[model samples]
Target chain A: NAGVTQTPKFRVLKTGQSMTLLCAQDMNHEYMYWYRQDPGMGLRLIHYSVGEGTTAKGEVPDGYNVSRLKKQNFLLGLESAAPSQTSVYFCASSSRWREGVNEQFFGPGTRLTVL
Target chain B: AQSVAQPEDQVNVAEGNPLTVKCTYSVSGNPYLFWYVQYPNRGLQFLLKYITGDNLVKGSYGFEAEFNKSQTSFHLKKPSALVSDSALYFCAVRESTSNTGKLIFGQGTTLQVKP
Candidate 1:
């Protein structure tokens, strides 16, 4: 299985530009998550989905939006890119949400640079 | 709210020596804790997690962590350090009360194992 895969491994965007980061998992997972990693900081959650057609905000959901239209895809959108949003973004999926029973599988990550 | 902390910014250990990465967490209810490792320019990999049951939970790459409820600490350990073990370590926590399945992470600790 491909597990989890992300689009645009690296991207450079200007302020106010908009783009969507695509995440797809072939594991038939039930939960999907979006996170950003900044220098010296742990990965901060941005958004997540419990199942298809459901999306929820995470710890740092501002400046971002997400959609999970299909079971295999979760997309994170930046309406207006900002310098603060420039970081490494990762996507993860889990078969379930229960503790001990859930182990997340992560993608290779997408490096975004907002100029 | 759930939060995690990694006291040390970086740890240096020689190859073949024992290594430990400290972590502490705070939560109102029963806490679910996890440890993840991130290699340079790479996404995070799940090292281990403690939900319930045993105090010492073993995980991938010869890594293990001890979950201390009283002390509210979960420290990652490896009997013999390897150069390959040098990377960034993260501690995360989630309150059992919340059903959002969101995780709060620490500021991250860099692990440096020298040969």
Candidate 2:
């Protein structure tokens, strides 16, 4: 299985440009998440979806929006990209939300450079 | 709020020697801890997790982690280090109180195994 896959491995955007990062999971997971990784900040959650048609803001969801139109797809959108938004974005999915037993599977990551 | 911390930025160990990457967490209720590994330019891979049963939990790539409830620690360990195991390790946790299903991650620790 492809597990979790992200579109556009790398992209460059000018200030104020908008784009969407697509995440697809074939594992039939019920929970999906979007996180941004900075040099020393580790991974910070931006938005998450518990199931299809359900989305919620996370720790760093201020400049981002997300939609889970289908169970296998979660899309992260940057309405007006800023230089501060330049970072590596990762998508992950999990089958459960109970506890340590539910391990998250991550995508290869999308490197975004907002110039 | 649930949070995780990885004290060391990097850990160096010789081949054939035991290695450890320390982690600590904070949560209101029962904590669910997890460890993940990331190779250069790749996505994070699941290692092991501590749910309920045993304090010591085994995971992929011959790695294990000890979960200490009193100390709120989950340290990743390996019996013998391998050069191939050199990578970035992350400690993560989720609070059992809320059902939002968001993960809190620590600043990653880079593991350097010298041959």
Candidate 3:
């Protein structure tokens, strides 16, 4: 199964331009997350969804929005891209927390560059 | 607030020598700690996790981590380092009380194994 897949492996956007990143997972996971990886800064959560139709802010949720309208898909949107937003974005999914599974599965990241 | 820290920005070791990557975390409750490795231009790969049971947890690619509650540290270690092990390592923690399964990541540590 394609554990997780991200659309547009690489993208370049101009300041003020907007775009949405799509993440799809076939593992039927109940939890999905969006994170940005900057050099040396590791991966910081931008947003996450516990289940369908639910979303919550994360450590660095500013300048980003997310939607989980379906059980298998999570989308991250940038309303107005900025140079500081340029980084490698990752999508991950995992089973429910109480099920004894705590490891998250990540997809190939999407590298974004905003000028 | 939950947080994780990787004290070293980079670690260098000779091939076939023992290697260690230090990590420490803070959380309101019990912490579910994890380690992930990322190759250049690739997504993060899960290495190991410490949830409960033995303090020494073994995981993928011959990596293991020791969870020290008193020290509040979970350091990744390998018996012998390989050149292929040169990559970026990250430590993360999730509070047991968090139903949302959110994780706080540390600034990554670069591991350089010289052949």
Candidate 4:
């Protein structure tokens, strides 16, 4: 089903440079999330969408923005990239709001390095 | 705020031996706990989760976890370890007042299964 896929497996950005990460899922999930994984830090949610045309802030949403204009796609944007934003970013999707039974399906991940 | 703790930084076990990865969490109410595995340079994959019902929850890759509500712990276990089982393990918890279903992850535990 292709499950979840992310564009640009790796990226390097200069400080102040802006960029967008694209995440697409073919599973028709109702929920999508953006998370960053730093060494020793498992994963931290940056933003999420409950459904199309909806977005919400997560635990660490300071430097990131997100949009879910379509049901199968979620995009994360960095207005001004910073060194602190260097990390592996993962995109995930779930069928519904409830977890456990509806565990998330993650993308291969996009590694970003901001200098 | 919900949080997850994976006490051990790393765990090593020989092939054919049983393996255990400890996890604990803190949340206001009932928590939806999850365990995920990540291979080198890859995104996390769902392993199992504990939401309700039985304390013993069985999941993928022949792994199981026992959820202890009183102790507030969910430990992942496998009867026989394999070299393929060597990877990074993450524990996560979901608790939301906004009902976004965002997840908070632990620092991660490295599992090394030697053959």
Candidate 5:
């Protein structure tokens, strides 16, 4: 299986620009998440969906929004780019907690730079 | 609030010698701990997880972590280090009461193995 894949491996944007990141997983997971990785800081959860059509805010969700229109796909959107949002973004998926706190599978990550 | 901490920003070790990565966690109830590794320009990869039963959890790439409830620690260890093992390591924790399976991640620790 391809596991999880992210589109737009690299991007550069100016302030006030907008973009969307695409994440797709073939594992049929029930949960999906978006996170950003900055130097010296570990990955922080941006948003997550418990299932299709359900999304919720996470630890760092101020500049980001997300949607899970399909069970296998999760999308993260930046309404207006900011320098603080420039970081490596990652998407992950995992089974439900009832399945025993399963480890999340991550994508290759998208490197974004906002000027 | 649930949280994880990696006190060391970086750790240097010689190849063929044992290595340990320290991690500590805080949570109200039982904690589900995990370790992940990130190679340069790559997404984070799951290393190991501690849920229940055995205190010593073995994972991919000859890595093992011991869960110490008394100390609220889960330290990653390998019998012998390899230059290839050099990477950034993250420690994460999820509260057992959380149904969404949200994880709190540490700041990450860089492991540098010299030949």
Candidate 6:
């Protein structure tokens, strides 16, 4: 089983462009999250979904939107991308809650470069 | 708010030698700590976690971490290093309350295992 998968491993976007990153998990997990990794910044939370049909803003949700319409899919969207938004984005899923439970399983990540 | 700190920017160890990656945390309530490894252009992989149990937690790929309450630290360790073990290591923490399953990550420590 492919635990977690992300589409469009690499992409380049111009300023003000919009794009979507897709994440899918076959493990029937209830929690999903989007995070961006930057140099010396660790991984910052962009968005998260506790369950299907419910999405919430995270620490760095300013330039992103998320939709969790299906149980297995969580999509992160960049509306008017900026150079600051150009980073490696990762999607993760966990069978249990992010706290006091199992660890999160991360996708292969998508590298986005905005110029 | 829960947060983590990876004090070092990188850690170097030779193959067949022991290695340690330091991590410390702060939280208002009970804290759930986690360790993840990321390779170049890849997603963060779950290495281990500390919920509520023994101070020592063992996880995948022969990696382990020690949770010290008084010190508020969860340091990752490996008895023997492998060249393939070279990667970026992150420490994360989540508070029990208000846990939308959101994780606060550290700045990350690059582990370089030389042969």
lDDT of 2 by residue, B1-115 (tens): 6789999999999999999999999999999888999999999999988879899999999999999988989999999999999999999998877576678999999999998
- Backbone clashes for every candidate come to 0, 0, 0, 0, 0, 0
What is the two-chain DockQ of model 4?
Answer: 0.69
lDDT of 5 by residue, A4-98 (tens): 99999999999999999999999999999999999888889999999999999998999898889899999999999999999999999999999
lDDT tens readout by residue for model 1, B1-115? 5779999999999999999999999999988888889898887888999989999999999999999999999999999999999999998887887665677889999999998
Cα lDDT of model 3 overall?
0.94
State each model's CA lDDT, in order.
0.91, 0.93, 0.94, 0.91, 0.96, 0.92
Model 4 residue runs over 4 Å out of place are: A98-101, B96-98
Per-residue accuracy of model 6 over A4-90 as CA lDDT, tens digit each: 999989999999999999999999999999999889999999999999999998898998999999999999999899999889999
lDDT per residue for candidate 3 within A1-115, as digits (tens), equals 9789999899999999999999999999999999999887888899999999999998899999999999999999999999999999999999998886578999999999999
Estimated TM-score per prediction? 0.96, 0.97, 0.98, 0.95, 0.99, 0.96
Each candidate: chain B TM-score: 0.97, 0.97, 0.99, 0.96, 0.99, 0.97
| Tens digit per residue, CA lDDT, model 5, B1-115 | 7889999999999999999999999999999999999999999899999999999999999999999999999999999999999999999999999999888999999999999
TM-score of chain A of each: 0.96, 0.96, 0.98, 0.96, 0.98, 0.96
Instruction: Enumerate the candidates' DockQ scores in order.
Output: 0.65, 0.74, 0.79, 0.69, 0.88, 0.72
C-alpha root-mean-square deviation, candidate 3: 0.9
- Cα DockQ of the candidate 2 complex: 0.74
Among incorrect, acceptable, medium and high, the docking class of model 1 is: medium
State in Å the error of residue A32, model 5.
Answer: 0.4
